[model samples]
Structure formats: C-alpha cells, structure tokens
Target: MNLPELLYALALQHVPNLGDSTARKLIRHCGSAEAVFREKKQNLLKLNGIGKTRIANLQHTAHLKAAEEELKFIEKNGIGVAYFRDQDYPEKLKHCFDGPLLLFYRGNINLQKKKLISIVGTRNITGHGAAFCEELIAGLAPLDPVIVSGFAYGVDITAQRAAVKHGLQTVGCLAHGLNQIYPKAHRKYMAGIEENGGFFTDFWSTDKFDRNNFLKRNRIIAGLSEATIVIESAEKGGSLVTADLANSYNREVFAVPGRPGDIYSKGCNDLIKSQNAHVLTSAADLVYILNWELPSTERAVQKQLFVSLEPEEEIIAEYLQNMGKAELDLIALNCKYPTFKAASVLLNMELKGLIRPLPGKLFELV
Candidate 1:
C-alpha cells in the first residue's frame, strides 16, 4: 500500500466502533479505505450492517493526524506493516474474522511456513511443564516447524528459547506495541529471537498497556498457527482461551496431560476429557494427527527399508496393505483386536513411518 492509502487505512482502523470486520465491509463496498471516506453517508447506509453508530467517528480529522504520526514512527523505526488484504499478511491469520486490520512487525520473520504451531500455557509454569516445553521443541526441530508464543513469562518464553536453541524460527506475539517489550527481563532474549524469527503486534506505539490486551493478543497467537498446544495450565488461564479460539477457527488443538491431582494439570485434563483437544504425549502425536510427512531425503536417511515390526503391527500392516484404506473399527475387527488396541498400534506405526492415518479414522500403508 502507498502512503495515502496506508494513511487512510490506518485512519479507518482508528475509528472507535469500526472493527476489523466492519472496516473490511466498508473497504470492500467502497473499493478502498480512501474511497470509503469519500463515499456519501446515504450510499454507505444502504449497505448491510453499517449503522449510523458504527461510522459516527469516521469523519473525525483527529484519526488522520494520529495515523500520520503512527506512519512516521513506523518509517523511522523500520518496522514492517501488513495490511489484512495484502499477500504479505500471515495467511492463516487472514482467515480469522477478527484479525487486525494492520499488523506491525520487526526482525526477520516469515509467516509462510507450512507447519506452524503455537505453544501457550500458564504464567506460573511447573518444572515439569518447562521441561516438556523444551523437550517438545527439541523433538520438533527436525521438522523445522515455526514456534509461536505470547512472549510472556513461563511456558511462552521457554518454548521460544528452545526454538532459538534448536535453530528454528519462532515468532513472539506481543500484547503491546513494537516500541516496547513487556516484562523488561525478556529484553536480553530479543536479539536472539530476532536473529532467526521476530515479533508481531497490531497495537500502536501510543496504545496503553492493559491486562485485557493479553486476551486480545491471544487471538493472534492462535490464528497464526495450524495448531495450538497447551503444555500446562491451571483451571482458568489465557492458554485455555487460546485453545478455545483455535477450536473456534476449526484448527487442531493438543494438550499434554498430567496427573489427576496436580493443580496445573486441571485445564489440560478437562480439555482432553471433554474432547476439545487431542492427547499430546510427544511430538509423534502431533506428527501423526497432523499427518506431516518428512521430506523424501530425510525419510531415506531416518527410515530403514524392510525393518521388523511387532507381530501385531505386522498383522495390522498386512491388513492395511491388502485393504488399501480401512477405518479403525473395521481393521480391529478383521485383525481380531479391540478398537482401542488397534488405534494405539496405528499411531505407533504412523510414528515409525510405516503406515499413515487418513481422515475419518481411516488407515493405510505408507
């Protein structure tokens, strides 16, 4: 977008009641943000869902002035800007109904990766949670998946630091503006994070820091990824909110289970029990559920041809090979195994790269 268009888009974003969805509606009807301002009120009122109250603040000159100042700050700081409709915007986030109208970013970040997962959890992370967060990232390193997090304390920082250590690109979704970093203690890690990945936010430099901002920020963390993983969470927390948002967006959600009596395990356990999230015991679970296949070269090096399988696995494999593709229960019944036992065997075979799972509970040889 050019200077005038960017200024107008920013001004549209500044209007109080004109949310991202409404702004998009106006922009599409009028052809552009600049054109939206030039459009007459009567014609604008003819459109659906555009009420007087929503556009009441559209004519305010103060918005333009604010946008100009923000544009100056963006130019001065060399920050990157992505309009919602632009090709440069995060593809997954663009599908979100309430994604920001504009996103400001810093560092060498790339949103085009095929496999992106968000890892979120409680601020008061337990030692087991922290260890799991690191181990999970390390295990996922071979896939070169992008790690995204809230950039706050506990699980978020642990995941990002692990991503950096594993030489994987990681994105930090911030609650505040690009001009500042929250929890000042994390300032030291910024350079390392920016070295490979970077930060993303929609809040302007002048926006106030508020607790509600974190909730709003949660949407971006969820929207940017193909899946959201909760390493740990208490009964009530922001990570659960992110998980809900991910589910709302029709994306996959996974949670690491803990003992029944543990306080931090309550949220994850509830999600699994309620079937809102899949049980994530290791990276293999994610790899299997998402059906992510390694590159041919990597597979050649990692998987041995004619490798031996357990007697039961060999039975399941022979059945799938002959059947082409079979549903879970059919395979179990034909092979004389219980449904649950057959499902577990299928998962292990998938992790071993021996067979693959299909949608609708179907399985087949690789």
Candidate 2:
C-alpha cells in the first residue's frame, strides 16, 4: 500500500465536517496522508475550504485505532484483506468519489482478476423477482464474470448463491464487519463462496449494526461493479437505493418488469418509467451492455479458492474478511450469537494463530 492512500484513508476516518470537497482541499494542501498528519492547525487553514472545527475534528487517534482494529480482526480470522492502497484492491472501486478507505476480504478469488456486475432486489422478494434472479444468474454464469451484491436476504443472496452454484466468483458486499455473516443461514453458501468467490466491507470491527451502514454499503456494491442490475424493488426499497447510488456514480442500473398489482414491482416500474434504470429482460442484455466474455477454466480458478474453514469458522472469517478486524460485539451482531460466545471462539482462534489480537480490544485475521 502507498503511504499517501493509507494515511489519507486512516486520516479521513477521523476527519469530521470534512465533506468531499473539504477532504480534497486537505489532500491537495498536504500532498499526502502522512503530510496531513504532520501539519499543524495553522497549516491546514491555508487549504481553501478547511475550518477550525473540521481541523479540530481531524484526530488521528480514532482513525488509527479503527485501522489497527480492522487489521487485527482480519489477522485473527485468517482471511485476506486489502485497503485502497493495496495492490489487490479492485480497480473499479478505486475511482469512485467516496470509495472506501479500506476493504476487508476473504476467499481465494482474485479481486483484480474478474469484471463485476451487481444484482440487487427487495428483501421481501416476489416469485417473479426470484425467477428473474435465477434466470439472470444462470445466464450470466457461463460468462464467468464476478457477480456483486449486498448479501441481503432477497436478490443479493440469490444472485451470489446462484453464481456459486454455477461455479462463478461472486462478491457480496456487507453492511457490517466481516466477523460474521449476516442473515446467519447464508453461511453455508458464504463459506462456499470463500472457497471460490469472496466478500468485502468498509466499516471498522467496532461499529455496531445500524440502519446507516446499508446505505453506505450499497455505494461500494454499485461503485465496485462495472454495472448494477435491479431484479425487483418496491417504490421505496433498498434495491432502488443501490440503483440511485449507481446512477449518481455514473454506473449503469437495470430493472426487470413486474406484473401489475405487485407492490414490490412499483419500484422497478417507476425506475424504468422515469428512465432511471435500463429495462433488462435477459442475461444477453448484460452481455451486450458490458461486453463480457465466458470464462475459461483457468480464469475461473483464478477468481476463487477452495475453502478449508468450517461453517461457523467461516462466519468469523467472513467478518474479518469484510472489515479486516472486529470486536466480540460486532462479530456477535453479524453472526447472531451472544458476545460471550464470540469471545470464546475468538480466543480459541487467536490461540491457533488464525487471527491476531490488537491493542484497544480488536482482533484481525493473521
């Protein structure tokens, strides 16, 4: 990882009142993350938009603790993780305006190897939506591109599991630390994915599950993918949130038509009608849109790794994979376990050297 991106990433986490524009100003003046941390308040004021509050809010401690915590969690889980500066970080995400400062990961898949397309839909999915997801995934499976999703119960899980079943690498973006898999039951396939595909997340290990995280998580899912496909969404559903983010990022967003009287169909219909999303009726539409090629055996193998972790072990691995580090509580939230139990597992795992303990109560995959 480069010093500039690393420092900027860490520093940005602590920089309050530092909107995108202010952040750019700080970066421009400091020339690098290391330089920014080295500068005094007066020096920061020279930047065009920086103010006293934002400067005061630029405490490196929070960022450092968060970064180190993330690293610790990952080390403990035995999963591989990467930040923006890491060579393995996916290229599609790096250019996004609000791309994550860091990304935790797991599995044997190559982040740099495959092209990405995100598929998303409602948590309360309809039959038509489910059909759309299955058919689309099966169609795209032969092409061998990486499928990206939020790992939410509906279309996201369907797309990811479908890709896995078809022997394609699928990346599921999470709203929480990788310490545990969300929705719990999905761990079976998530473990399967780690052996082949992978997972990614941006939050620190200490952050608890909250409403805001999903909104933030969606951006990366959209930004990381070359394009996004909406299988189904209500008029105001989470899937559309991803579509809007994809559009704001200037990425393509697609929606499938639903039958009339379906409440879940309203979102898709409105998007198509408003011309917010492209009407995608088939995998061919994606193929034509993205110009993807079918993957050879060599390419597919390069995208994923066979897993050795047990189902529960992989749950912890997923947490570390997403945030690169985590605390007991965060792991519990993701895994749906009590914090005390998560601690016991962490202790056992740490003893095995699958993960390493960090200062300030964090653990990361080794």
Please tell me which predicted candidate would have the highest lDDT against the true structure: 1
Using TM-score as the measure, the top candidate is 1
Summarize candidate 2's per-residue lDDT along 1-366 as a digit string, tens digits. 653465456557556556544555456577665667778888888766677777777754786666556555656787555665557778877778787756777777675666788999898877667766776776565556788888889888888888888888888888887776687978777778887878888765667889888898988888988788888788897788889989988888888877668888889899999999887766655655665643444233321255355566678878888998886567778888644346545544544446666766577887
**Candidate 1, residues 1-366: lDDT per residue as tens digits?**
788889999999888877888998899899998999999988998988888886668888999999999999999999999998899999999999998889899999876755899999998899888877876776677788999999999999999999999999999999999989998999999999999999999999999999999999999999999999999998999999999999999999999999999999999999999999999866767877898876655455433678779898899988987899998879989999745456656755665677776878787887
Clashing pairs in 1: none
Off by over 4 Å in 2: 2-8, 15-29, 59-70, 293-366
Model 1 — TM-score against the truth?
A: 0.84
TM-score of 2: 0.73
Clashes of 2: 29
**In model 2, how large is the Cα lDDT of residue 185?**
78
